[model samples]
Structure formats: structure tokens, C-alpha cells
Target: MAVKLATAMALFAVGITTGCQGMSEQATNADSKLDLAVSQALAEKDFRLYYTTGRRPVVPGFEQLAFKELEAQCGVKAMPGTGDTLRSEADKKARSEAYQYAREFNIKMYEACLNRR
Candidate 1:
């Protein structure tokens, strides 16, 4: 009876440890997802601003300053090629549509980020 009780207690402790590890992993994943959403939103906002105004959202030398700030805050790397393709597109309507899409998408991402928080 003593041996059985000790074995049960040992198993319970192991289960608790495993459960805690799983919870930690889940929280890490949630944080990563939130960071990605925020990064994407920031990039989209910059892209929209550039498309509509024909200028970078930030100062010329520091085009990616917002991205760097995001990395400093959340440890998420900025996505590459954001707004690069939109620059050379010749059609004005296409550019306008892209800008609108970015605006709407940024709104959704912002909402998602808020919900996650």
C-alpha cells in the first residue's frame, strides 16, 4: 500500500509539471501571434501612407524606424518587401485599391491585437 501511494504521488507531480510546461508554451505562442499581427498592421499602415502620399511614412533616412521600434518592443522582425511592389505600379486605380485594402486590413489587425490583449 505504501509503494502504491508513493507511485501515485510521483505520477501526479509529473503530470503537474507537464501541464505547467504546456501552459507556458501556449502563452509563448499567443505572444508571438500578437507580435506578428502588430508588425503586419504597422507595415500595412506605412504602405498605405506611402501609396496615397507618394512619400514614406517616416523620415527619408529612417524608412524602417517603426519596424525597428516594433522589434525593440516585441522582438518580432519586420516582414520584408512590404510596399516594395506597390511603388512601380502604373495604374492609379490599382494603387488606390491597394491603399484602401491596406487601410481596412490594418483596422482588422488592430482589432485582433486589442482582443488578444
Candidate 2:
């Protein structure tokens, strides 16, 4: 009986540890996806701006000008980073939603800018 109880407990602990590791991997993947999405959106925006205006997008002052234009014309605000601390599931969800919003907003602004040019 004692051996059986100990074996069962050991298996249970291993299962819990495996489950926790899977959850951590999932969270890391989620964060990576968010970062990739944001990066792609910014790249698209920069490309469109350069194509329309015939100006390089990487100049620091010009980038700030584009951001300010986005703010004024699209009423978009900068999205804040999650910083160094671990985020809860709810926080991750909210950040994902915010990123989606910003991405969509920037795309719309790009369209409007292209149309005006």
C-alpha cells in the first residue's frame, strides 16, 4: 500500500510539472506572436509612407513626424510595452487586443495617407 501511494503521488507531481511547462510555453508563444504582429504592421506602415512620400522612413525625426501625424489624423495613441515583469493571462489578453486595435488603426491611416497623396 505504501509503495502504491508513493508511486501515484510521484506520477501526479510529474503530470503537474508537465502541464505547467506547457502553459509557460504557450504564454511565450503568445507573446512572440504579438511582437511579430506589431513588427509587421509597423513595417507595412513605413513602406506605405516611403512609397507615397518618396522619403526614407528610418530617419528619427521623420519617424516621429509620422507618429505625430498618426496621432493627430487617426486619433491613435502609442501602445505601451509589457515591461520586464511576468504578465497574467488577463493582462496578455488585453495587450493582444490593444495591439490588434493599433495595427488596424495604423493600416487605416496608411490607406488615408495614400489616398491623399
Candidate 3:
């Protein structure tokens, strides 16, 4: 009975490790897809269209999944902030800072995903 229990525990550990490896592979693929999307957008000058239409860049589903996985792994907490009603220079500066922070956050998420398992 003890030997059987030990074998079961070993199998469970192997299963978990295999599952993590699969997830890591998927995350790597997701990361590649994100890079491709960014390259395509840059090549197409999508930023200009976004600016004209006031539409933000779309995050692909795989990227979103990878980000979610990274967020879970990193235990990142989101901070909610209130936007200023007036568009003063200070407000604009704050908004710019917020965007920088957002980009940094996403980059971290991507790195985390790529580093998984």
C-alpha cells in the first residue's frame, strides 16, 4: 500500500510538471503572435488610423490569455484612478505618465508569460 501511494504521488507530480510545460509552450506562442501583430500594425501605420478614429489597439485573444496567465502568476494588483475633469497641462502630464505605466505593466506581463515554466 505504501508503494502504491508513493507511485500515485509521483505520477501526480509528473502530471503537474507536464501540464506546466504545455502552458509554457502555449504562452511562448502567444508571445510570438503579439510580436507579429505589433509588427504588422507598425508596418501598416495603424497608429495614424487609431489616432484619427480614437480607437485603441486591439489585444489579440492569445495575448489576452497569456496576460491573464501572467497576472495570475505574478499576483499583480490593479490600481483604480479617477481621471481629471479638466484637460490642464498637469492633467495631460498625469495622463501621459499613466500611459507609460500601463505600457510598462503590459511589458512585465509579457515577460512573465514568456518565463513561465
Candidate 4:
């Protein structure tokens, strides 16, 4: 699963570069495709577009909205992570594991929200 996600992320990064180069042509030719791409990218938590365009990719309050809606449907909050509020990493390996687990939970919640839509 990690390998597949890494591959997808690589491809998306490449696409972002190419897409920006021909911005005008792509905008005219692929408006609908662009819309769908944006939808799936958000659903799948792919934020390479933001990196390439220097734009804020997600809508304001998106996380809060998702938390509320998913809680209503799933009877639990979709947010994960330890919050790491302390800003201290006592163990590097443990922190890495926690980050990986949080990423997986994010993907799962993204898919669930997409299905609900």
C-alpha cells in the first residue's frame, strides 16, 4: 500500500509540473477533466497541486466540515494523530510510526467521505 501511494504521488508530482507548463491550453481543453482531477485529488489527499501552483488547495474549513459530517455518519471523529501538542519527539522511531499510522487513517477517512458523497 505504501509503495502504491508513493508511486501515485510521484506521478502526480510529474503531472503537476507538466500541467503548469501548458496552463492555458490545458485550461481550455480539459476544464471538466480538471474539475474531476481536483475532486479526486482532494478525496485522495493528493496535494501536489498546491506545491506546484503555490496555492491553497483545500477550501476553508474543510477539515472541520469533514469532522462534523463524518462524526454524524460514523459516530466517531475522523481526525487522527496524537496532536503532538508538546512539539517534542522523545523517540524518532515512535514518532515516525505514529505519522505513518495517521496518514493511513487520513486516507481511510478520505475514501469514506468520497463514498458518502
Candidate 5:
């Protein structure tokens, strides 16, 4: 009976290892997708800044600076408080869309990692 139980455990382990052969590629792909999303965000921010003030968004540290301070922190490139603009609203919407995509992809990534056992 003990030998039978050990055999079952060994077979289960081998089955699990065999099942996870493709998991690494899936995770790398998801990480790549996430990186692309971040790049897109950076590009959109750059374009918006250029369209409004002909400059790119500035970051003092690893953290980001807010849009309101752009006029002051970014010098003349960030002048004239535009108040609220159509593009600002559109940009917010687009960012929300990106967030949703990231969330979905991250969930899949999590599931893939969990199943790798």
C-alpha cells in the first residue's frame, strides 16, 4: 500500500512538471505586453504636452509630476493655465482604457504563474 501511494505521488509530480513546459513563454509575453502599455502611456503624455506647450512631461524623481504643476515646473513650456480641455478628458479616458487592459493581462499572468506548480 505504501509503495502504491509513493508511486501515485511521483506520477503526480511528473505530470505537473510536464504540464508547465509552456508557462515561461506565457509569462514573458505578458510582461512584454505590460511594458508596451507603459510605453504607450509615456508616448501619449509626451504628445499631449507637445500639443499644448511644445514640451514633454517632466519628472523630478522616479515619481511623476502632476499636470497642474506643468506650467510652473516645466517653465514657459508649461504656461497659461488651460483650465480644462477636451484633450485632457480624452487622455483620461484613454488612460482608463489602458488600465483596464493591464488589469486583464495581469490577471492572466497571475493565473499562469499559479498553475505552474
Candidate 6:
């Protein structure tokens, strides 16, 4: 059973290492997406008109109001628009703007939890 135990431990180690590498890569991608998103959001005001709407005016989303206030406090603004889905906006160049806006949803939902300080 010693041989089996050693093999299992080795497999476990390999799995952990592989999982960590994947996590690291995902983190890198997430950071780049997030940075681009924040910069874009800061530059634009009425996000409801950008990308998806392409400067067409429409009502903002429910959460957007909170973010709008946050942007005002930080003196930032989001391009007014949204993509078909929140998670996958950057797939197309035209949709990239939407993807960046989607990140605001991520920031408000996920990143806020990390800023407990």
C-alpha cells in the first residue's frame, strides 16, 4: 500500500500545480480585462449609449445608478451600452465596449467583496 500511497500523493501534487497555473493565467487575463474596463468606464458618461447602442440613448440598468453615483464620486463615467451577455462582450471588436462595461458588473458584484478593509 506504500507504493499506492506514494503514487496518489504524487498525482495530488501534480494536480495542485496544474490547477494553480490555470488559476494564475486566468487571473492575468482578468486583470487586463478589468483595467481596460475601468479606464473605459471612467472616460465615458452615458454607457447606455455606447457599443450596443452606439450613442443611442436609453434607460440605464438598475445597478447602473449605483455605479453612476460611484463614478460621480470618483468623477468617472461609463459608456452607455450593454452586450447580449455580461460575461462575454469582448468576443467582437464592436462588442469589446460592451465587455468592458460588463466588467463593472463584475467589479460591483465580485470585487466589492474583496475590499472589506
Could you list the CA RMSD of all candidates, in the order they appear? 16.3, 11.4, 16.3, 17.0, 15.3, 8.7
If scored against the real structure, what TM-score would every candidate get? 0.38, 0.38, 0.41, 0.27, 0.34, 0.43
Ranking according to TM-score, highest score first: 6, 3, 2, 1, 5, 4
Per-residue accuracy of model 3 over 1-117 as CA lDDT, tens digit each: 999999999999999999999999976776676567545644553321110002323222223444445444543333233233436878667655544444544564445445544
What residue pairs are clashing in model 4? none
Report how far residue 115 has shifted in candidate 1, in Å: 19
Candidate 1 structure, TM-score to reference: 0.38
Model 2: lDDT equals 0.52
- Give residue 68's error in model 5 in angstroms: 16
Off by over 4 Å in 4: 1-66, 77-84, 91-96, 112-117
How well is each residue in 2-92 modelled by candidate 4, as lDDT tens digits?
9999999999999998988799775555556545655675666544211001122221223345444544453333222333343456644
lDDT (Cα, tens digit) per residue for candidate 6, span 1-117: 999999999999999999999999977887787667545644553222221333332223333445444443332334443434444434465455445545454455333323423
lDDT of 1 by residue, 23-67 (tens): 999767756764675577566643222212333432222344584
Clashes of 6: 8
Clashing pairs in 2: none
Error of 6 at 38 (Å): 1.6
* Predicted structure with the largest TM-score when compared to the true one: 6
What is candidate 3's CA lDDT for residue 33?
Answer: 68
Task: Give the best candidate by lDDT.
Answer: 2
lDDT score, candidate 2, position 40: 73
* lDDT of predicted model 5: 0.45
Q: Point out the worst 10-residue segment of candidate 5 by lDDT.
A: 45-54
List where candidate 1 sits over 4 angstroms from the true fold.
46-117
